[model samples]
Structures are given as C-alpha cells and as structure tokens.
Target: MNKKVMSIAAMVAGFGPSAYSLADSQHDEAIERGQAHYLLFCANCHGVDADGNGPLVELLKVTPTNLTTLRSSGSEATVAERVLQAVDGRHAVGESAERKMPVFSDNLEISTVIEIAAYLDSIQK
Candidate 1:
C-alpha cells in the first residue's frame, strides 16, 4: 500500500480503539466508585473483601453471596442486571416476605447503583 493509504488505515484503526478505550476508561472509573459504595453499605454483609464473609454474616440467618465470583459464574451483563434489579427493589419485591436483603431503591440513587454494578463487574473472578 502507498504510504498515504497506510497512514490513513493506521489512523482509522487508532481512532476506533481510542473511542472504545475512552468509554472503557469511563466504565472503569464507575467501577471504582461502585466499589467505594459497596464498602460503605454492602461491606457489612458482603464483606470488605467481597467474599461473602462480612462480619455481620454470623448474625444473619441466610448466608451472604460471594461477590467476587459473580462474573466467573455468569455473563457480566447478567450480573449487572441482577444487581441493578435487586438494588432497585424489582428483585426484592418478587421475593417472599422473609427477605434478608434490604432494598436499596429507596436509599440509593440510580447512579450509585450503576456505579456499584460497574464495580461488581470489575471484581468478578
């Protein structure tokens, strides 16, 4: 290929991943923020390490889930969907009256929930 044509191709390829990287970096930032949120609210039950070994686990009748392995077991999209649903109360309401998990819909903003989902996505085993 001519030098000019090769240069053009290089530019095009560079531009593509640049756009994707920008968005990917933004998503990474969201995940970091979500981890912070999880620590503040969920860490009590999910554990600071996110291994479902939170200090409060002994007090609860039901066992907490291991947050780290969520992605390894399922698609990232499905994990995020489930997390968002539970945070928003859609999953909570569907559960029986003896729900152990608190519905964050009333307390957490949508952005916060999204951040948490992103964080969970990054930490998956």
Candidate 2:
C-alpha cells in the first residue's frame, strides 16, 4: 500500500481497535506537489503568499490576480475549475491588449495543472 494509506491504517490500528478517520490522501499529495510547483513557476509573479505582490509584479504590464480571494469572487465555476482554465490559457481573468501571464498550457502537464489548481483551492479565502 501507499504511504498515505499505510499511515492512516497505522493511526487507526494504534489509536483504537475499531476507530478510524477519513482522509483524502490523493488531495493532500496533490496540494503538496502543487505548492512546490507554484513556488517554482508562479512565485516570481504571484508572490509566495499568492497575493499578487511578487518581486516581478512591477516589471509586468498587468498585475497578477490575488489567488486567495478567487473563490469568493462570485464566479459560477468552482475555484479548482477556474484555476484549471486560467493555467490552461482557456480563461483570462483580466484581459487587456495583451495578457501578461504566459500560457502554461504547453509547458505544464495536465496533471500538474490540476495539482496546481488543488493547491490554489486549498488557499482560497
């Protein structure tokens, strides 16, 4: 079994004979991977805090969107879906003469994009 399942089983076996807790191991793993990817590819423009105040923000013509408030922005789509679209270059949050954010569709794997979305979703306020 995977480490996640093993750990959860250990907790159940050790904590109580017939007691157990639910955990989405895949989601947790995705978030971890997403955070690492975000730090590597997005932090320069989106900030480590994801507040759109990264070191390279001033250099761009358009400011990056603050990711923490995305879910509360009243969009019909779920935060994860919106993030997926944005990263895939299918949805532009702030369209100008030219989009400042590069299209990551070709650069990142689909699973990687989903993981990034998962991470973004976890941080939404």
Candidate 3:
C-alpha cells in the first residue's frame, strides 16, 4: 500500500484510541500492582486508605505518616525519595533512630517499590 494510504488506514483503525487505551491499560496495571504492594507491605502501618490509622497503630511508639497527604502535606519529591529509601531498607522518612517499620528491600523489587510510590502519589488528598 502507498505510504499515504497506510497512514490513513492507521488513523482510521482507531489507532489514536488504541494508543490511548494502551496507556490507560498500563496506568491501570501500575495502580493494581502498586496497590498489591501497598496492601502487603504498607497497609499494616499506613492503613488500607493510607491514612496513618492502621489497626496496628496503637502498638507503635510513633505514628505512621498519612500516605495520602504526602504531597499536600509536604514536598512531593521529598516524600517520594523518602518512600523509596524507606522501602529499600535505608532511612525511615519519619521514623526515629530506632526505626520500627519492616524493611522490604530484600523482599520487594525496586520496580515494585516505585509502583507503590506511584500509586500512593496518585491517591494523595
């Protein structure tokens, strides 16, 4: 087929919508994966709603930061970096020198941590 005809066919095939659908699919996948990680690793402290009111809160010396307001409450970049480090078994963003949160660096992949962060950021209140 001629180049012009091929281009026209591509456009007529809902290529534009297909591309958009793919992007939406990817976003949805990311959110799902992220939510899984959050539920497994974070919900215990951050709560299912990321509200810092997890069931385990009464047992802890320090309160968990509300994950949903990480950006509105403070710097988004700072929050993201802190989350990345916390998940990687490094510094705890808001923890004391005697950190209490479980480190998942060995258990979770970097990509998974990133997905969780993206999900958390997207749900910011």
Candidate 4:
C-alpha cells in the first residue's frame, strides 16, 4: 500500500472500537468489584440501590447520603474522588464531632476503595 493509504489505515485502526471495549471492560470490572464491597459493607446503611434508605436507617442517628444524586448534586469533585474521600472519612457530613460513616481507610485497600468509588459513580443519576 501507498504511504498515505498505510497512514490512513493506521489512524483508523487506532480509532477503532477496541479502545472503547477495553475501557468498558475496565469500567465494568471496577463496578463489579465495587458493588460486591458496597453490598458487604455499605448496603446496611446506603441501601442496595444506594438511595440512602437502607434497612438500618431507623437504627442510626443520621441518614445515609443518597448516592444516586452525587453526580448532579453540584459537587466540584468527580463522583469517584468524592467517594474516595468519603471512604477515607475525610468528607464528614455534619459538625456533630461524631461521624456516622465508618472510616474504611484502615481496613480496606486503596484499590478496593477505588473500585467501590467506581461502582458508586456508575449508579449516579
């Protein structure tokens, strides 16, 4: 093939759907891991649908944040970064000096935190 033809073909190949597929794979994987962890740790408070209406709501002094609205809630940070901070307990809700959200920074791996964040981001409205 001519140089121009070869270059065009290369460009087209580089822009193919495989790139999107790879990204989608990684995104799906993260979401899967995140969902599992959320179910195990957060579902008791955050709810399976992450609507802040978990079964334990009545037992807690503070209501869990409705995670479905995080993206549209006018927060400056992206959903993932916000979740990371929250999991680390750096983003407390009220000034009560006692945070209801348990800090997972000590027990969970950072990668696990990121995966949980990824899952939360996927469910945003």
Candidate 5:
C-alpha cells in the first residue's frame, strides 16, 4: 500500500471502537452511582477522597487501605475481583480484620458493587 493509504489505515484502526468503548455510556452511569454510594456509605472510613485518612481511622485497630494505591501493581481485573470479594465478605484484609468495614452484600446491589469497583479502578495510581 502507498504511504498515504497506510497512514489512513492506521488512523482508522486507532479510531475503531472496541467493546469497552461501546460500554462507555453504561460505565459512566455506573461510575456516577458508585461515587454516590461511596460517599454515603464508605467515606467515613475509606475517606471522602478514598485516601484511607477518614476521621474514624484513628479509632480502628487496623488502618484502612489507601484506596488510591489500590491498583499500583495489580491489573484492573484483579482490582475489580478484590473489590467484589471484599464487598461480599469473601476477602477480608487488614482493615476488615478490625470489623470496621461492613459486609455490603446486604446493602448494595451486585451491580452497585461492580460499579464501585469500576470507579475505584479508574482512580488507581
């Protein structure tokens, strides 16, 4: 192919939509819900900014995980898995040991938990 044709093809390839892009609208809506849920139920311990420095941190025997660093090493899928497990009470961590974090399975819908996981994953360091 000519250089110009090759360049055009490259541009088109880059612009092609993937499955994730097709779900962007849904993901955006989910993120909004997750943000609201986090603020209302998780902020007191996870912190409003998700930095694990909430006012109640000092009272707890175990420190909350610094959520901002949640994805420092793991893939997004791994992070999502961990978040789901934690919410479902299947994956307790240091903070969970103190029983400070409640099992959200009864409170949050599965979709909401997944949404929260997506939002948290989006903000990873």
Candidate 6:
C-alpha cells in the first residue's frame, strides 16, 4: 500500500475506540436519566430495585411485575412491544390483572419512553 494510504488507515483505526467510547458514554447518560425517571414515576409501584414489591403494591388491587424478568418473555421484540403498550396505556403485559398502571404518554416524551425501555433492557439478564 502507498505510505499516505497506510497512514490514513492507521489514523482511522485509531479513531475507532474514541468513537465507541463516546457512544458508550452517551448510552450511560441515557440510562442514568431513565433510572431517575423510573425512580420518580415508577418506583412507587415497581419498587426502587424493580422487584415489584414496593410498599404501595400492597394497597393496590393487583401487584406489579418484576421488571428484571422481562427479558425472559422470550425476545427483545416482545419486551419492546410490551413497553410501548404500557407507556401508551393500551395494555399491561406482565402486571397483575387488576393493576391500574397509568399511561405515561401524556406525562413523558416519546424519547423518554425509549430511554426507559433501553434502560430496562440493560438491566435484564
């Protein structure tokens, strides 16, 4: 290869890790925001750790689902779909039948919902 071409390739290769690190940093920031939003809006029912044993769950007609298990629902598509429905208030996938989880469409922006979904996915084992 030409010397100039080889140098350009080396420079481009060196930039890869920095670009990936920046993207990772942004993902971390999104997760942090999602965690804050979950704490403020969902922790009361879902619990601070998302185990679904929050104090308020006892008073409710139904219990909330342990969100950490959402990945076991079979696939990422299913999880994403359920999250969208819950956020949209059309249905509650894993929660108890009588639960009255409020729709967040009006209270949160669409980007917030996406971030929450991403955060939830991150925590799923």
Predicted structure with the largest TM-score when compared to the true one = 4
Please give, for residues 1-125, the per-residue lDDT of candidate 6 as tens digits: 33533443343333233545657777677778878887887889889888888779978876887888886966444444556567666653544454367778788876676666656756766
| Superposition error at 74 for model 4 (Å) | 1.6
Candidate 6 shows a clash count of 0
Candidate 2 structure quality by residue, lDDT tens digits, 5-114: 24433432332213224446655777799899999988899999999999999898888889889879887665665665666566645444455578887788766766
Q: How many backbone collisions does model 2 have?
A: 0
TM-score, cand. 5 vs. native? 0.72
Name every residue pair that clashes in candidate 4.
none
Across 1-125, the per-residue lDDT of candidate 4 in tens digits comes to 23532443343233233545657676677679889999998999999999999999999888999999987988765666567667767664555656668888789876676677767767778
- Between the candidate structures 3 and 6, which one is better when assessed by TM-score? 6
Clashing pairs in 6: none
lDDT of each: 0.67, 0.70, 0.67, 0.73, 0.65, 0.66
**TM-score of predicted structure 4:** 0.77
* Candidate 4 wrong stretches, greater than 4 Å: 1-21, 92-98
- The top-ranked prediction according to lDDT is 4
Provide C-alpha RMSD values for all models, in order. 12.0, 9.8, 12.0, 11.7, 11.9, 12.1
lDDT of 2: 0.70
Tell me each candidate's TM-score: 0.71, 0.75, 0.70, 0.77, 0.72, 0.72
Runs in model 3 lying further than 4 Å from the true structure: 1-22, 76-79, 92-98
- What ranges in model 2 sit over 4 Å off? 1-23, 94-98
Backbone clash pairs for candidate 3 read none
Residue by residue across 29-100, what tens digits does model 5's lDDT show?
Answer: 777887888788777888988999888898887777777787675534355666666666655455535445
